[model samples]
Target: MPRSRLVFWLFFAPVLLWLLLLIVLPHLDLLTMSFRGENDYGEMGWTLQNYRNFFTEPVYWLTFVRTALYALITTFITFLLAMPVAFYISKLARSRVRGALMILLLLPFWVSELVRVYGWMILLRESGVLNFVMLKLGLIDKPVEMLYNDAAMIMGLVYTSMLFMIVPLVSVMESLDDSLIEAAHDLGAGKIAIWRTIILPHCKPGITSGAIVVFMLALGNYLTPNLMGGKNSLWFTEQIYNQFIASFNWNQGSAFGFLLLALSSLIIWAGLKLTGQRLGEVAS
Candidate 1:
């Protein structure tokens, strides 16, 4: 074989193997499991009952819709928060300041996600630091319960998902020409006009990519919603977890997982369509 061909195989082999073994094969297994069920004779056979249950059951479908909505909201919120920070680091800050700001953003991720969620709990719980400070400052009559609710869950989701949104935005925004902004300003464009016409158009790909990733992460997240929202967290992933871990219903869990995969894909497709972004461009 040619040297170049051999070198190409050497580099490609690991990635191919990793995709086949870790992604494709596992998904295939789940697909099969999702269609399998036991009949009245107690014999396992192919059936659509697992998928059907998701629709026939109100709790299952309602939770699925609710999770999707929350994930979308979290993605939008994360984008809103990350955009200004990314713009500062990419366009406004000096190199030294940018590096320091990036480090600050990344510092929390050095800890495990579980640890970070617990940190939020420490800050947000009724008897936690936030309440103590509020009470001391006479800001409240009593310790306000801040944890175990949708707002808390959304906060935790945004915190965890913020870095993903910022990194992509920063990467794309760094390539934007400062001259474009200066020229627009010289032509009497205001801040909002500059952002609307120049910056936003330039960052479309990054925004689409980051939004897709954040949405998927928020959709599939178990720890943040489970811990922060507590018993009230009616997330779809929680239902999937209950099916697999608590009830030992792998078929049902697999079905739920596939439904989640479908939901994410559909939402992302719709978003890209609405934004006039092709997946290829976003991926690049």
Candidate 2:
């Protein structure tokens, strides 16, 4: 073989193999399992029963919709919070200050996500740190029940997903020309007008990419909802976990998994259509 061809294969072969073996093969197996149902003989038989179950069962369908809505909300919240931080780091701050800010943002992630969720639990649980401090300050007569609720779950989701949104926003915003903003200002364009016309359009790709990633993460997150919201967290992922682990229903779990895959893919496609951005451009 030619030297160039040899080098190309050497670099790309492992990636190709990894994609095929780990991602493609497992998903293919899951796809098959999702369509299979148990027969009278207790053997797997091809059928649409698994998918039908999802539609007919009110709890399952409701949980799925609720999970999607929460994920959407989390993505929006992350985007709102990240934009200003990204703007400051990329456009306003000095280089040293930007670096320090980035380090501070990233430092917490060095700890395991589970550890971070537990840290939230420690602070928010009744009789925990927050309540202790508040009580000591005479703010409340009793400890507040802060954990095991929707608010706590949303807090964890936002905290964990912020970096995903911030990185992409910073990447796109850093490339924006300062001269354009100055020119807009001189032309009597206000901050809102400049943001809508210039900054948002320029950052469309990054916004789409980040929102897609964060939405998917929030949708599929099992640990944060389970740990933070306790038993009341009616997340779709928890249903999947229950099917696979608690109920030992692999076929049902696989069906739920594929539904999540479809949900993420459909939402991403719709977002790209609405924003007039191509998948390749956003991915890059």
Candidate 3:
């Protein structure tokens, strides 16, 4: 047994080491880099200026808060919409059609999110498909500006994150016993009562997990907001990208990245605490 345990650890050790080297080491490097950096003349020194700049800059803080709020709104909307769809997939779908429907639901995953977002762009932009359709319908003589707005940003986020929310919800819901729901119904529980009392409590882990994933992705997103929201959106991750790529302020960029990491960790912890859950249980 001791020899077997040693062999097992030896096998696992390289994988752990690889993870530490690639992921953990890079993060540590980023933390160090955020504190210490070079000047234009290539002189290096440690400084707190990155954090100072982020806090002191109004646009940086505003974009960060805006991104957080946008992600929150998207997560909430995804939960509201995904629950019923997941339930339908789990409870209402027949075996004959279920496979087909599941495939159809997941077909979008095969398409790139960038492509999907661009499709939305074409549809929402002025003088684009939507405007053309409205013009033909005589709804208005002029095309309304639809893109580069908060609504556009939220729509893009929801579209991007919906699959993440739906898949986990469906996975968790599919395993739930129909008899439990029947028992609730037999106990004179209405649809709302059954949903509130029986369904919500059971799927808390999936909801929590899905929320963390979607929220984290959205909060750190630079692409979707930039493409869909245009100049008006001003997402926080974009600010970090600007710092690193445009301004060549690697220290400030690293600081923003670490700030995002800290915020994401806090959100994940709060979600776990709120749901009183473990992902292992949910997956099992």
Which structure among the candidates has the greatest TM-score?
2
Question: Which segments of model 1 are wrong by more than 4 Å?
Answer: 4-14, 273-284
For each candidate, C-alpha RMSD in Å?
2.0, 1.9, 2.2
> Could you give candidate 2's per-residue lDDT for residues 1-284 as a string of tens digits?
45688899998999999999999999999999999999889887998999999999999999999999999999999899999999999999999999999999889877899999999999999969999999999999999899999888998999988888998999999999999999999999999999999999999889999998899899989999999886756999999999999999999999999999999899989998999989898877
User: What is the alpha-carbon lDDT for the whole of candidate 1?
Assistant: 0.93
User: Which ten residues in a row are the worst by lDDT in model 1?
Assistant: 1-10
Number of the candidate with higher TM-score, 2 or 3: 2
> Candidate 1 on 1-284: residue-level lDDT in tens?
45688789999999999999999999999889999998889999999999899999999999999999999999999999999999999999999999999999889877889999999999999999999999999999999999999999999999998888999999999999999999999999999999999999999889989999899899989999999996866999899999999999999999999999888889899989989988888877
Model 3 earns a TM-score of: 0.92
lDDT of 3 at 231: 84
How many angstroms is residue 189 displaced in model 3 relative to the true structure, after the best TM-score fit? 1.5
- Whole-model lDDT for model 3 versus the true structure? 0.87
lDDT of 3 by residue, 1-284 (tens): 35687788998999999999999999999999889876577888888878888899998888888888888999999889989999888889898788888899999868998899989989999968999999999999999989988898888888888988999898889878899999989989999998888888888778888888889888988778898886867988888888899999888899999988888878877887777876566445
Per-residue error for 14 in candidate 3, Å, reads: 3.3
